[model samples]
Target: MRCSCCQKELINSLTLQELFFSSSQRCYHCEQLFSKIDQAQVCPGCGRPNSTELCQDCCLWQQELGFVMRNFSLFSYNEGFRQWIETYKFMGDYRTRGAFVLELTEALQKYQEYLICPLPLSKERFEQRGFNQVRGCLDLTKRSYELLLKRSELAPQSEKSREERLQMKQPFELNVPIEKIRNQKVLLVDDVYTTGRTLFHGAELLYKSGAETVKSLTFAR
Candidate 1:
């Protein structure tokens, strides 16, 4: 096998349990390039590492929105993560989606009862990128998901300043029937969580549409 990130030949060094149960696709060296977040030490609201309680950003969200978000993130948005995203998302290297399949699959087990919903890309963005980055990762997990939201064309989040992101208007509209969301739990999936604006907007819409609960998961924070 070859490492998904570096394309180097992989060495078979897994223990029996790992060999049987693990679905990791990257070599040790490539994997080590990214930093993992310790769930226990993270902020209760947004999963910011080393935080004991809600981070300031999350507290602000609660003050403004009347609810706090429960987000789980696996990796820190460090240099390695930025590089990976640059290649996988901006460079349109679709195959890099496999690099985190094992991590995503394991993390999602806890939300098995919740409907998985990957954030939608605007039509223009999807055409330019050729795929929805969040959905690309979710697809490799072989899990079912719903395209329950449609996005309007807008500036990409990556290009927006923190103030701009926070001020941005809601860009998502429900793409499915209200009955589909009513009384259901939803797990919103995204490639990254920046200022909490985008996810909060989606959550607000779901809550107003009668969703029982809404949580979010992102590969990076």
Candidate 2:
């Protein structure tokens, strides 16, 4: 195998334990670079790796939005992870999906009972990208829905400041009826959680539609 980010050859003798249990497709160095969020040290709300009792973003979210969301992220949005995202999601290197399948699948298993939903892309973005980045990361057993639709093209969230992201108009619309999702627990899946703007927007719509609980899971934060 080779490192997903560096494209360097990986050499190792597989142990019995690794053959049986390990699902890593990347080399040791590349794998180590993609830092996993330590569950014990994460913020209660956003799941970011933090030493603080409550991360400033989460605290601000609670104060201004009057609610807090529980989000679980697998990896930090570091340079390595960002490049991997660029390749898989933007460059359309579909084979890169294999690198994350096992990890993403395991993370999503706990949310199986909830209504799993992938964050939608605008029609233009979908045409440009040729696939939904969130959906590509998921395994087939994990069912998802097109519950939300991107109403129109907007500025790339990456280009915006935190305040701009938080204040951006709601971009998602419900394709499913409130009656269908009423009292349902929703798990919104996405490729990345930057300022939590997109996920919160989806959550707000779900809440307005009477969802019992709204949470999010992302590949990176």
Candidate 3:
């Protein structure tokens, strides 16, 4: 057998867990395999392309945007994955989340010491969208959870340019006190991380809340 992405030959040492998790099918491996510090190919979480370092555009964007840190991921928010995410979270298509959760499980299996938090949608948005994509991912994973904050119903950051996104609004608020998160590691989960404003805001809330370190894993980055 061969890995679809990297074209590496399949090895018998690959357990059923590995095979299943790799398929976007395993709930356990989806929960565990996604939290690693490195990516076997693309990141199992955010799908950031190519290695530990950033691309030139990403570097400049990060510096200009004042984002402190960003992490890698698994699937790019291209057409196939994008449609799948939208359907699963917004359109009541749970199968897509189930499949992605299996993929997530395979990716996160070896990870530890990270508390997971789903990105929150404002109450109105939740009502409009019907479900939080992050919530579905969390429901599938067995990681610890912390609601470090609640996101407000701010203007669409995605519609704005980078400058506009930063200037638009405060983006998030800490419902969970800072005292509760001191010196802890946190792994933030989101359905997507395009432009990264949302994840950055979430990380800021956690950091201000006294988390020792924070990492993120989104379905798309």
Candidate 4:
């Protein structure tokens, strides 16, 4: 076996249970490059690490927008994660999508009853990138997801400053019929949670469209 990120031979021995029922695409060395957030020690609101209470961004969401969203994330957006994103997303290495499948699948088990919805890339961005990074990961899980929202082309979030991101107008519109969202519990999936602006924008739309509830999950925060 080999590590997906480093492409080095994986030397760890697997237990009988692991060999029979578990799969690991990333070796311990590569895995150690990124920090996994301990769910119990994270912020109740945005899942930011080391926070016993809601983080500042979450508090702002509640006070200013009158919106509260529970976002669960698996990893921190550390240097290693940034490099992975650069290769997989920006450099168009589609195979790297499988690296986090096991972790993502485990994290997603509790949201089985909710409709999985990957946040969209604009048509222009999709053409340029060749795939939606979020959808790429979800596809490997063989999890059914709805393309419920469509995004209009704007500057990429990576190019925007935090202030610009917060001030941006809504970029998403419903892609599916209102009946699909009406009264459904939605789990918005994304690659990362930056300032929570993008997720909140999508959640606001879901609420206006009559979704029973809207929460989010991301690979990183």
TM-score of each: 0.88, 0.83, 0.68, 0.87
- Distance from true location, Cα of 64 in model 1, Å: 0.8
- Candidate 1 residue pairs that clash: none
TM-score ranking, high to low: 1, 4, 2, 3
Q: Please say which candidate is ahead in TM-score: 1 or 4.
A: 1
lDDT by residue (1-221, candidate 3, tens digit) is 54322234445576787775554333442233333223555423234665444555456645765444546466655665655555666677654455555557655654477766677888888888777767766676665577777876576556779987765566678767667678988777777777766777777777777888777877765
User: Least lDDT summed over 10 consecutive residues: which range in candidate 4?
Assistant: 15-24
Worst 10 residues of 3 by lDDT: 29-38
Candidate 4: where are CA atoms >4 Å away? 6-9, 12-23, 153-168
Per-residue C-alpha lDDT of model 2 across residues 80-168, encoded as one tens digit per residue: 88878777787898767756666777877888678888888888888898987777766443555555545545689999998978766
Q: 3 or 4: which has the higher lDDT?
A: 4
Write down the lDDT that model 1 would get. Answer: 0.88
| Better by lDDT, candidate 3 or 2 | 2
Model 3 regions lying over 4 Å from their true place: 1-22, 26-47, 61-67, 153-168
Clashes of each: 0, 0, 21, 0
Give the best candidate by lDDT.
1
Candidate numbers sorted by lDDT from highest down: 1, 4, 2, 3
lDDT of each: 0.88, 0.78, 0.62, 0.87
Note each model's CA RMSD in angstroms: 4.6, 5.1, 8.0, 4.7
Candidate 1 local lDDT, 1-221, one digit each (tens): 77876777877776788766655667887687578898889999998999978889988999999998899998999998999999899998887887887788999999989999999988988899989999988988898999878885577889999997875688888999999999999999998988888999999999989999999999999
